[model samples]
Target: MYSDDELRPVSALQHFMFCPRRAALIYLEGLWSENRFTAEGRLLHRRVHDARRGEKRPGVRVARGLEIRSYRHGLVGKADVVEFHSSSPGQSPQVTIVEYKRGRPKPALDEPFHVQLCAQALCLEEMLGRGVSDGAIFFGRANRRVEVPLDTALREKTLAAIAALHELIGAGRTPAARYQARCRRCSLLHLCLPKALRPRATAARYLALATQPPAPDDA
Candidate 1:
């Protein structure tokens, strides 16, 4: 278990991992400016989170907006949906966390979503005293659910990411922009102008005349 002073929210780890500046701005400075993407996600979550009044069907119960907290990791979260599995009405409950995302499944990275879901699992496991072996990510764009296993590998990665996040926050450093194509759509593009800062923009004319191959050596 971790002390409250030593723990950071799981969502912060994802933001810090993706872009430190953005994380710092949001967490430390309390700055937020939502665009179309963020607005859409909020609307989607509102629908599910608002429907959390517990509905029962056979041996399963669907719960929404389940409050969750992990003291060991220093995170507070809410599951958009939780499916409680029971063999009988009197049996102990097993929890399965489901998170809602506004985009389709990611291409090469699951770290961000996994960390968030893992944190919820940790909270549920602590509160319920049962192992959480798996969870799901529901993508809004694709209307699909992705099952993620809580294997040793994912657990280790999630913990490691938490540790790294603490170190980064402690150091108070923001990484320089790498200026990839992804920057174009970033909400912070106006704040992070890689194109304007590029050396090519300042030296384009000088290089053009110098690289004319020296007029065939003027023999």
Candidate 2:
């Protein structure tokens, strides 16, 4: 179990999964830059979280901007929305965490989002002492929600990601950048400078040259 001081933001898991160097730059080096995508995402979240305090309707209760944390995963963040549905009186409610996104879902790049939802479910489970088997992601662009199952695979991946995030933060050293297709979309592209730093030669050869001690000058 991690202490409160040791916990990192749950959102960092998505960043880390999308790009390790991007995570390090933002979480470790405290760097951030706003782009169109990020701005839209931020606005969407703000709108979701701005909903009035929790409300109950018939069989369901809706909460907005609910703060959550998990000692097991060493993560903390606020949920955009969480809905609880109670089937009958005097029974535990089923929890459904809803995350809002700005763009349409992209299956190829949805792993990070899945990991994020799973992490949030884990936090809810720990806090409520109940199983949270499902969640949803509401895409603003599509105006639809995609249901996600909190299965063993997703849980395992979420745990592994948390561990990796802790390790990366503890290392206290930024990783060297490697250019990739996704770098174009990264808001930290200017700060990361992957293209400028990426090796023209083989990666191993570049590392050797970079780490090798300079030759002593002869008189």
Candidate 3:
């Protein structure tokens, strides 16, 4: 188990899954840049997080900006919303975590979102001492919600991601960038300079070359 000081943000899982080098850049190297995509996402999260009050419905209770954490996995973060649905009068309510996103759903590119939701569910379970069978991601552009099962496979994947995140942060090394189609959407594209640097060289190696002394000429 990791100490409180050792815990990393749950959001890092999404970053790590999206691109390890990107994750290292943001979390390890403290690098960040804003683009339309990131700005929109931040706006959506800000709106959700600003609503700090909980509302009660007939059979459900909705809480916004719920802070959650998992000591077992050394993860900590906030959920956009967590709705508790009551089945009976006195029994514990079934938990459903809701995450708000700014764009439409893209199944091909949404694994990171699912992993993020799963991490939220894991943290919720630990916090509430209850089982979180499923969660949902609400897409603003799509105006729809996609349900995600917190099954063993997804839980295992989330745990593995948390482990990888911790390892990456502990290593304190930014991964070498390998340019890809998705790099265009990355906010750190300019900072990463994936295209300028050779894929085989580490960021440290590239920087070293930039500052190295001129080579001696052969006589």
Candidate 4:
């Protein structure tokens, strides 16, 4: 049974998207190692996440590390930053989930970050009982916010991803590796060594056949 804590971190989507084996190793088998990139990312998030106070800038208000949960999707996580805007002080505010990324947009979908933002929007919608309008992905390098609409298609895709994530995590086995261009950028290359291990499996099969006794021939 998954505890509430297990169900609750946005980081799980990151693992589920990155590699099922990696997710299982960390979440289930209790393995964790921090690389320099991860360390720096953590340092950047620390100050942003630690900010409990809200800052006002004209019509917008920025709140950091806000707790978020989505009963509809059975997901929970914290938003890096949520911006709120209102017509007046007493009026209900419009919420936007702005995810802070340490890197620029990649050719491939940053599934982890995308999924995280979707989860945040889901949570906000549930809490507000009103549909969320839009969200944004803020890249530190670019120093800009790319607005993302919470449209029907994106919502459906996010839900599907969550379902897939749940299935992958529940399964105890890791997926077999296949090389792709993305493998070069993978942080787990040293740990995975997919290419190195492939030939070894083939060699083991050949060696086993060589040692096997011949079967009796039928006349």
The candidate maximizing lDDT is 2
Runs in model 2 with CA error above 4 Å? 201-219
What local distance difference test score does each model get?
Answer: 0.73, 0.87, 0.86, 0.71
User: For model 2, what is the alpha-carbon lDDT of residue 214?
Assistant: 30
lDDT of 3: 0.86
The order of the candidates by lDDT, greatest first, is 2, 3, 1, 4
User: Which 10 residues in a row give candidate 4 its minimum summed lDDT?
Assistant: 210-219
Worst 10 residues of 2 by lDDT: 210-219
The reply for model 3, stretches above 4 Å from the true place, is: 199-219
- lDDT string, candidate 1, 1-219, tens digits: 767666566667667656676676666656565667777888998999987479887877998988877776666667888898886567777768899989999857656888778877887888777898879999999999999888888888877877777776667765554567765555655444445545655566445543443222121
Tell me which of candidates 1 and 3 scores higher on TM-score.
3
**lDDT, residue 64, candidate 3:** 92
User: For residues 115-203, could you state the per-residue lDDT of candidate 2 as single tens digits?
Assistant: 99899989989999999997999999999899988899888998899899999999988899998999878877666767657767577
lDDT score for residue 157 of model 1: 80
TM-score of each: 0.79, 0.89, 0.89, 0.79
lDDT of model 2 at position 111:
92
**Which of the two, 2 or 4, has more TM-score?**
2
**Each candidate's clash count:** 0, 0, 0, 0
Model 4 lDDT on a 0 to 1 scale:
0.71
Model 3 vs. true fold: TM = 0.89
Residue 14 in model 3: lDDT: 90
